[model samples]
Target: MTIISLQHVTKDYGHGRGIFDVSFHVKKGTVYGFLGPNGAGKTTAIRHIMGFSKPQQGIVTVSGLNSWNNASTIQETLGYLPGEVALPEHLTGEQFIQMMMDLRKIKDDTHCKKLMDFFELDASGKVKRMSLGMKRKLAIVTAFMHDPDILVLDEPTSGLDPIMQQRFIDFIKDEKRRGKTILLSSHIFTEVDATCDEISIIKEGHIISSFNKQELLNMTEKVFHLTVENTKDYTQLIQMIESDITFQLISKNEQINELQISCYPSDLSKLIKRIADFPLLSFSEVPFSLEKHFMEFYDRRVGGELPWQ
Candidate 1:
């Protein structure tokens, strides 16, 4: 089931700013990753989903209700952590948490306590005195305290330390296990690669690529690194690769007699057979990564064309 959706959403802010023609859906019980660099309108699109800003075109919905019309209900129910957190300086962290609970009319503090303990947050300190990391922990605690079925987290681990970031990732996995639907907007490749079921890459106010995690992992071409035993073998290998239509040479180093190539998984046998003619020092498959795929869109020269495109 589609729990959250943005249909052809556009929010133009002039000067070529803001999200445009952004569309994607977050299915129930799955994590949808919204991947983009800073100033790519990630926050703009998320703001529309949260109903903090209305879309100038198209529809934004959560649980089938129009986000603009049902802002209060959606904001109150969904577990949301904004990209930039702004807390009341006058209130202590505990007081702020209590205030949120009161606003949501939540009577149970069991989950709230667990979140506090899990994040190691000391909410007794005033919000004004807390460091950026502490403030982020507090924000995370409050966001999940209610245990909402749906969550919208923007740059959730921005201010966290490495250890805390891993803890947050683990927490997200636990939430996924409990059947929570999540829309995670982030620039952190590791976190998204670790948790997302589906990923959408946005750039300069536009979505460039949207795909299933497994589908990307199953890309037809696999990259491998090779080191030849001698310069003669390396030179011959390059010549053979140049002549073969199946192999795509990514890079080569003549001095070290090393080369990288991309070949179809189905052509592995053929590749092995051909390479056997050359003296090889070592051969290893370079692990496929989301970062490599992401970089394709990130590169301005590529014009946002996906590998398959």
Candidate 2:
């Protein structure tokens, strides 16, 4: 089921810099990553979906309802954790949870204690006395306890400790198993790589790429690092190899030359066969890394910008 859709959804400040004609869809029971760098219009797009701000152009729909027209109803079914959380200093953890449930008119507190115990949060502690991580944990528990169908989280795990982060991952997995939809906005690629089924990357307020996680992973090329024992520079090795195989000599020492090469699927056999010529002291085909893939995308975006614009 298509749980959420944004069609040409645009929001901008005075400078005409925000999400420009952005469109995407989120399916039910899947996790989607909304990826971008700072000032890439991620927060603006999120605000429009949450109905905190109205879009100047285009539409955002959740469960077939206009995000702004039926904001309250949409919110009832949405669990949101904002990038920046501000809790009143005077309110205790327990009080805050009660206030949240009151606004939704939910009388049952069944999940409150359970969530607190799960996160090891102190419900009796005042907001002012709690650490940043503790406050974040409290917000996370509060957002999830209501059993919402759609979760919209912005930078959800920024301040969390490693243990809490692992637990959060477990929580998202459990939510997905129960057929909940999640939209996660994150700069942390590793977390997104681990949690998201589909990912859309935005750069300078534009959608650069959108694809399924497994597909992207498969497209990432494996890098082969070779250090030849024989005395040969990168130029000599390039001359010896066939032209179809793409290779780059990264560095060279007195006795060995280091090369970073990529082999296309069709050329994998040819590439392995050609390596027999060089005295291979160290030859390792490194697995593709999500971090490297993310950097490559970012570099392309940065380098492709027009000079005048």
Candidate 3:
């Protein structure tokens, strides 16, 4: 079931500064990724879903209830972690957790303790003295303490180091397995790929692409990086790709006579045969990457087939 839906949502801030004609849905017990960079309207669309801002042209709903009209109830029940975490500097982390618990009327501290421990957060320190990563962990702990059925996390690991980022990624996976519905918005490609059941790439206030995890996997393309023995082979290789559609030129380094090409699994044998006789310095297949597909969408013109597609 769709737990959240936005139909033809348009929130135009003058000069193309807001989401426009945005529409997507998040099913129950799935992670939906809103992938984009800063100023890509990711935050804008998220704000609308959370009912923090009303859509001027469409409806935003959570569990079939109009988000704007039932804003309080929706926000109260959903665990939300904003991209920029703001906390009271005067309070210790423990004190802030207590305050949140009191405000939400949560009598159970058991879940909160587990979250703090899982994140290795030391809540005795004052917020003012906390490092950026520490502050981020504190925010994560509080957002998840209630163990809400649904969560909306925006750049949830913004200030975390690599270790903490991986921890957050693992945490997301654990939550997914528990059947929690999650909306994860982040520009980091790996986290989104690792956790999301569905992905929507939003760029310049518009959702340019959307696909499920299986679809993305089904469309995966293998990239091969190889260096030829000399310019003769390199020129011939480039010409070969230009003539046929089987091999796709991804990149080239003329000075070193090296180049990268993408080959669909169905055509890998054909590519190998076509270049088997060429004098080569080295050849290797690069692992599949979602970033490649994402950048193609970001850079391609208004109507062009995606490289992976």
Candidate 4:
């Protein structure tokens, strides 16, 4: 079942800003990754789903209810962590948590205490004196305190330390096991790569690519790094590669006589035969990683052409 969805959603802010024709759905009990850098309309798209903003076109819905029309209901029930958290400074952390519980009319504190203890949050101090990491933990605790079925987290682990980040990642995995639907918007590749069932890369307010994480992992293309023994062999190999269409040169280092080439697995035999003709120092295959795919999109957005293009 589709728990949350945005269809042809557009919130154009002019000057080529805001999301355009964006569409994606988070299925029940699956974690969907919304990948993009800052100012890439990630927050804008998320805001539409949370009913914080109305879209100029298309529809945004949660549990079959229109987001804009059912703003109060959705906002009150959905677990949400904003990209930037702003807490009231005057209240103590304990008091703030209490205030949230009061608003939600939560009588039981079992889950709330578990979240605080798991995050190691010290809510005794005033909110103003708390560090950024502490504040982030507080926000996390509050978001999950009510045990909402659907979670929409925007850059949720921004201020967390490495240890805390890992804990949060683990916690997300646990939630997934418990059959919770989550929509995570983040540029942190590792977190998304580790937790998401499906991922969509958004750039300049457009959904550039969307695919199952497993499909990417099972791609047939393979990358190999070859290091020639000398400049003479390297020069000859470069010529051989340029004259053939079986492989694409990803990168080259003249000083080290190293070349990174990409080709299909079926062509590996041909590559080996061609490389055998050259005097090489070393050769190794580099595994494809999510970071590499993410960088491809990011590089293009920053005015650099894609490696394949």
Candidate 5:
């Protein structure tokens, strides 16, 4: 079942900014990645979902409860960590944990102690004195310590070191195994690619693409480098070859041609047969990286170009 849904939800900033006609859903027991570059209205959309800000138009609901109107009630089953978390200066890590426990009315301290131990967090230090990474870890512990059914984390690993980041990823996986619903928003592509079940990409305040990992892998092309015996026009050569396969010329110098392309296993034989005509000196196919795909999306948005174009 859908745990959260945003229908025709539009948040206008008057200057023609903010999310426009945005819509998507997060189902129960799944990890949904909320992705886009900075200032792409990801934060705005998140705020709307969390009830920190009301949408200018349309519906935002969590578990069939209106997000804005039923904010407090919806938050009962939700766990959240904002993009820019600011812990109280006067509070120690222990104090902060205790405070959240108090508010949630959690009678037992078992869960809280386990979380701190799992994170190796030192709870005795004041929040103001902790390093940025340590503070982020504390925030994470606080968010998940309660083990809420639904978690909405914004830039959850922004400041952590590599080791800590790995731990956090493991934590996410563990939570998934327990059937927790998660909505993770981050500019870090690999984190999303690694932990999320499906990703929804928003650009210029609009959701442009939503696909699972396998779906994206199927859509993206793997580039190949071909070195030929002679300086021939491989454009028409590869073009005719790709007629039965899938490939495209990325760049060409005198004796070498680089093609950024992809086709299924069903078409691979046809491509190999075509390459046989060129006296193939050396050939190699390189798969697409998650970082490259992310950069492609970011570059398009930065250049103000339509994603589909």
Candidate 6:
């Protein structure tokens, strides 16, 4: 079942800003990733989903209720960590957690205690004096302490250190195992790649691609960097590829007698045979990376028209 849905949601801020015709759904017990660079309307779209902003056009719903009209109910039930956190500076981290517990009517502090330990957070310091990373941990603890069925996290690991980031990623996997529905917006490809079941890439206020994570994980296409024995081999290789359309040349550097090519596993034998025909030096297959696939949409201008690759 769809736990969260945004249908043709448009919130035009003008001056070429805000989400346009953004449409996607987060199903129950699945982690959905919303990816984009800075100023790409990721936060804008998420705000609509959280009912923090009303869309000028289209519908935003959570659990069959209109998000804008039922904002309070959604906010109360969903565990949300905003991109930009706001905390009461006067309160210590401990006090802040207690305040959130009271607001959520959480009678037990056991889960909260576990969260603090799991994140390795010390809530004794005042919010104003805490380091950015500590504050982030505090936010994460409170946001998830309730263990809500649905979660909306925006740049959830922004201020965390590398170790803490990994911890958060691992926590997300645990949450998925527990059958929590998650909507995550982040620029960190690793987190999305590690945790998301579905993904959407938004750019220039439009969703350029939406796809299943398996599509990326299961991609058979690969890039290989080849170093030939001599200048003669490099020259001949380019001529060989030009004559045969089998191997695609991505780039080359005559200075180092090296070239890059793209091919699938099916063409591995053909590629090896062709390379063996020349004075070979060395070749290595470059592992496919999510950053490369994600950046392909950066230079694109078709808005929401581009299909997922």
Full-model lDDT for every candidate: 0.90, 0.81, 0.89, 0.90, 0.81, 0.88
Which 10 residues in a row give candidate 3 its minimum summed lDDT? 300-309
The residue pairs in collision within model 4 are none
RMSD of each: 2.2, 3.8, 3.3, 3.6, 3.7, 2.9
Off by over 4 Å in 6: 217-220, 227-242, 252-258, 265-283, 302-309
lDDT of candidate 3 vs native? 0.89
Q: Work out candidate 1's RMSD over C-alphas.
A: 2.2
* Model 1 poorest 10 in a row by lDDT: 300-309
lDDT of 1 by residue, 1-309 (tens): 999999999999999899888999999999999999899999999898888898999999999999999988886669999888799899999899999999888999999999989999999989999999999999998888888999999999999999999999999999999999999999999999999999998888988889999877777589899999999879989999999999999999999999998898778899999998888889999987888778767885423556575
Estimated TM-score for each candidate: 0.91, 0.85, 0.84, 0.83, 0.83, 0.86
Record all residue pairs in model 2 with backbone atoms less than 3 Å apart, i.e. clashing.
none
Ranking by TM-score: 1, 6, 2, 3, 5, 4
Whole-model lDDT, candidate 6? 0.88
Which wins on TM-score, candidate 1 or candidate 3? 1
lDDT of 2 at 12: 67
In model 2, which runs have C-alpha deviations exceeding 4 angstroms? 227-258, 273-283, 296-309
Output the better candidate (3/6) by lDDT.
3
Per-residue lDDT for 1-309 in model 5, tens only?
999899999999867579999899999999999898888888898899899899888999999999999998987889998888699889998999999888888888898788888888997999999999888988988887778899999989899898888888898889999999999999898899889988888878888777787776665555677766554645656666457435555665643554444555556676678777766567888756777777766666433553333
Give the 10-residue window scoring lowest on summed lDDT in candidate 6: 300-309
lDDT of 2 by residue, 36-88 (tens): 88777788888888988888889999999999999999988999998987987
lDDT of 6 by residue, 232-287 (tens): 87899988877877778989989999999887667888888888888768889897
Model 6 collision count: 0
Predicted structure 2: lDDT:
0.81
Which model scores highest in TM-score?
1
